[model samples]
Target chain A: MPEITILTEQELRQCAAVDAGAVEIVSDAFSRLARGGVQMPPVMRLDVAEHNGEVDVKTAYVPGFDGFAIKVSPGFFDNPKLGLASVNGLMILHDSRTGVVRAVMLDNGYLTDVRTAAAGAVAARHLAPERVGTAAVLGAGVQARLQLKALTLVRPVERAVIWARDGEKARACAGELADELGIPVEAAADARTAVEQAQAVITTTPAGSPILHWDWLQPGTHVTCMGSDADSKNEVAPAVLANADGLVVDSRSQCAAMGELHHAIAQGALPADIQPAELGQVINGELPGRQAADEVTVADLTGTGVQDTAIAVRAERRATELGLGTRVQA
Target chain B: MPEITILTEQELRQCAAVDAGAVEIVSDAFSRLARGGVQMPPVMRLDVAEHNGEVDVKTAYVPGFDGFAIKVSPGFFDNPKLGLASVNGLMILHDSRTGVVRAVMLDNGYLTDVRTAAAGAVAARHLAPERVGTAAVLGAGVQARLQLKALTLVRPVERAVIWARDGEKARACAGELADELGIPVEAAADARTAVEQAQAVITTTPAGSPILHWDWLQPGTHVTCMGSDADSKNEVAPAVLANADGLVVDSRSQCAAMGELHHAIAQGALPADIQPAELGQVINGELPGRQAADEVTVADLTGTGVQDTAIAVRAERRATELGLGTRVQA
Candidate 1:
């Protein structure tokens, strides 16, 4: 019988973290993605309309990797009322050569959170100014804190501001992050106030309408929008892309369908024929990211399956080395 | 923390079997699929050409069910030389309301086998003649045996014939089935002789070319072609589909892409615009199946994600009722 290791969220947390190492790992995946040879199909989505929930299935087979990962993520918007988190999932890594189950990471989206944050850090490292003294996060959720924390690893983010529709929740999040990161963090009066004061901004909300406007962006400012993953969600105004000096996306095809670029093209703010440079291309030096120090760069991150496979492989290897998780005959 | 049940193949075998109940379960899923309101995504496939392997991911959300299932199946064709099974993977059942992981079934293709065989029985029950005295199965593999056994659940099959490219393996399979089913079973001289002796004929081999020709099919024979699930695989000649009196498919769109119909359409044996009735439609009485006793019917069984969800739900329920798995904090 083949053996499979089942690692829980706690075990996975001990293996992978949202730090410089994770950023580098994700960056390397992006570089390879630009060079080609990765087999990644379009994301499979299932909407449970009755339960106000949705599930997305993603996977990628990267060459030279011993294993590939398949990740299943479910989001129930009403789960908070039931005393549960909104997002939870598990990742399965299979041996590439034998197609055997190597490990099952019941991470409950911890690894996704890490990988997503690392992706944001990669964007900042490539597009943000040399020194980012203040970083603005437009959400009061788990991703807001992680994105800011990850930004600190890539940029000199000495202070941060939190802004959300609910001022009290934003204040609470800001206070928590202030102590956690040992940085001066405060809740902004509004989205405009947050964006106007920062050199680097990250949007991490599930908003259906634009919360950040084009007029709020300053020269040399870098924005990483990670909220608009679905067709219905939009974090920045369509004009933001139209007016930006540099536009990049994690996946150009995916962004054209569901990202901020989708809204831009639909609203006629950007030409329908426009094809922005992909983050992978910029990472591999095939295309430039931020051409000038004063250019306003925007990186729309809709996420990709390659990041999931990379993080899952890293977590499984570290957990196995640490002797964590339960092993059973598969 | 949420709790997740982990059931291995041994535990799954104790919970579900390829019997009448399994057939009914699968039949009801087909009926539901025809009635509408089922959220099933297209199968996601990853081809690892270097290792001669492939992985397919399938999932569906059926209304009124408490949970849905996502199945990951991997087939490495070269694994048999390394003393390993070519096909093995796991299924996950998630709560529909909360989007939380409820159970993990590590059946390693056992449940898939039972579900697939049950689907074959479903096709035979609805499309075959009322009295099926003899059944012929092409192939000497595990599915060939299970398909024959499942036919006995729906029809009064007293005798069976086994045929394969390897005559010795066919003879061995015939002996095993004769002992297991308590029925007279024999190895046929060729595919023609096998189909000529039985009222119900099933094709279960993964042949890329036409293994069963049009001229081999006898009058009043009901054929269930289950081997051509991929684009490159074809079990029966295109003329069989063109000459059949009644043709049904599990999913019209899927069959047109990768099933026997795909071959027929490509060869111009069937019209490019042909839209055959689905098995679900026939089961729900929306369309006709086996119109007459002497009708030469062909039911293409390409399989569907709804079948996986049905079988996984049944297995999890039975396993939970019997306390047949290990429960861990998810």
Candidate 2:
């Protein structure tokens, strides 16, 4: 039997990160997906209502790639009461050439957080305004901070605003982002205020109701709706999606099934039969991105297996280069 | 983050097994499934034709169970030419209470093999004839050997016959089973000869075409079609399924989607809308198994995520009892 390598979170963080070329890797993966060069199956999502938790299993095999990843992401919503962070999981990468598992990434959800942030960066790079000064994020969470840190990889921002249902968490998130990114980040007075003052906006809250509305958006703002990955979670209003000049989704079918697009279609704000263009098409230059300087664009990133596979491939390569894992036969 | 436990194949073998109460655990799981207490989604199956590889992700949250399992099973059909076994993978067990990962069973496909074999045994315990002196198996592979070993836990078998496309592999399998089980096992002249001499027939090949026909079975013989889990794989002919006195499937929906029943329905031998009795129903005593002494019963084992979760829960319990596996926070 072939041996397997185990990469812990410490090594993974040292090797692959959201700040370091993750946007490029995930951006390329999206391009391949749009070009029909990837084989991605429908995600296997299991809702463990007993624990108020849900797990989504995602995977994809990219043609010509030597490896693929089966990512297991679990969100335990009620974990905070027990002093737990509420989300956890890992990614298992296999040798696509032979179907042999080559490495087990015990990332404990860090990889997912970074990859998600990178996906947001990819959206910002392709759709955001050329001269972005200030950015706004709806949500004070790991992603709120990580997304800002990641967006710096694509768009330059001098200041940022954070809005959250919990006012204190928003202030804390803003402070953390300011310290980490060395930029002027502060809490916004309201979601509308945040949306009106920024050239780019990223929604990262797990809100069950519409938190960002169409009327609040600036004319040329590029919005990355990144929270509505489940049926019950909607971060942006349906009108916001329907009113956008350009709308792209990670996967049209998935967006229609579990993302913000599903809620929009359910509410009759968006047509049920509309086949939205994938963000990959925009990234691949097959579709127009930011066609006009004042065109309001929205990218729905419900997440995709292709991103997981791409991030994992890069992580493994970097892990190997740094000699940062233990090879075990047992 | 909660700690993660890694249970290797060696420790898994020493702690838990298919013959040791797996049927009871899996049988209970099946009953729960039949009672609508299992939250099992559609399987995520991705086929990579470049390597003749296919990876299936199956998971279920069985209500009232303290944990669930997400199983990643891969089959690379061309691995045998490189002197490697074609099937491999692992199971990730998560705590139901907090949605935290409890253990990683690096069984190297051992758990899958055993759980599958145990499912066949569960079928035999409920549906097979009372008086079984001999058994026959088509296709001499890992499953072929494991199924016989598992069946012994449910029925008293004195002898067995093996038939395979490769005559040499069949002879070798027979020799190995005979020496291992202390029973008179030998290769059959043909599939018909094997079927004619046994009370139970288990077909375990990944053949794309049918190997067993309707006319090949005796009166009172029970057929377990265990190989046809994919759309392109078949073990028994459609005519055989159409002619059976009783036809039960592990999962009615799955069987209709991509199992032997799929082929039968496609060929018009079985009605497309006919909802077959689930093996769980038979196990739960909600439906009849073998109605009469001369009745021919066939069980289509498409496999289920419920069984994986049940087996994984048991394996984790046993591993914990044995004080096995390495614990880490990653």
Identify the candidate with maximal TM-score.
1
RMSD in order of candidates: 1.4, 1.9
In angstroms, the error of model 1 at A224 is 0.7
Candidate 1 Cα outliers beyond 4 Å, as residue runs: none
Error of 2 at A227 (Å): 1.4
Ten contiguous residues with the weakest lDDT in model 1 chain A: A19-28
List the TM values for chain B, per candidate.
0.98, 0.96
Give the clashing residue pairs of candidate 1, or none: none
Decoy 1 TM-score against native:
0.98
> Model 2: per-residue lDDT, tens digit, B1-330?
578888888889986676758988988889899998578999999889889999999999999789999999888999999887787788999888777888888888888887899899999987789887889999999999999988888888989999998999999999999998899999997999999888999999988988999887889999999898888888789998999999999999899988899999999999999888898899888999989989999999988999999999999988889898888777
Per-chain TM-score of chain A in candidate 2 equals 0.97
What TM-score against the true chain A does chain A of each candidate get? 0.98, 0.97
Question: What tens digits encode model 1's per-residue C-alpha lDDT throughout A1-330?
Answer: 689998889889899999877898789888888888888889999999899999999898888778899999999999999999989999999998998999989989999999999999999888999988789999999899999999988777889999999999999999999998999999999999999988999999999999999899889999999998899999899989999999999988889989999999999999888989988899988899888988999999998988998899888888888999999886
DockQ top scorer: 1
Clashes of each: 0, 0
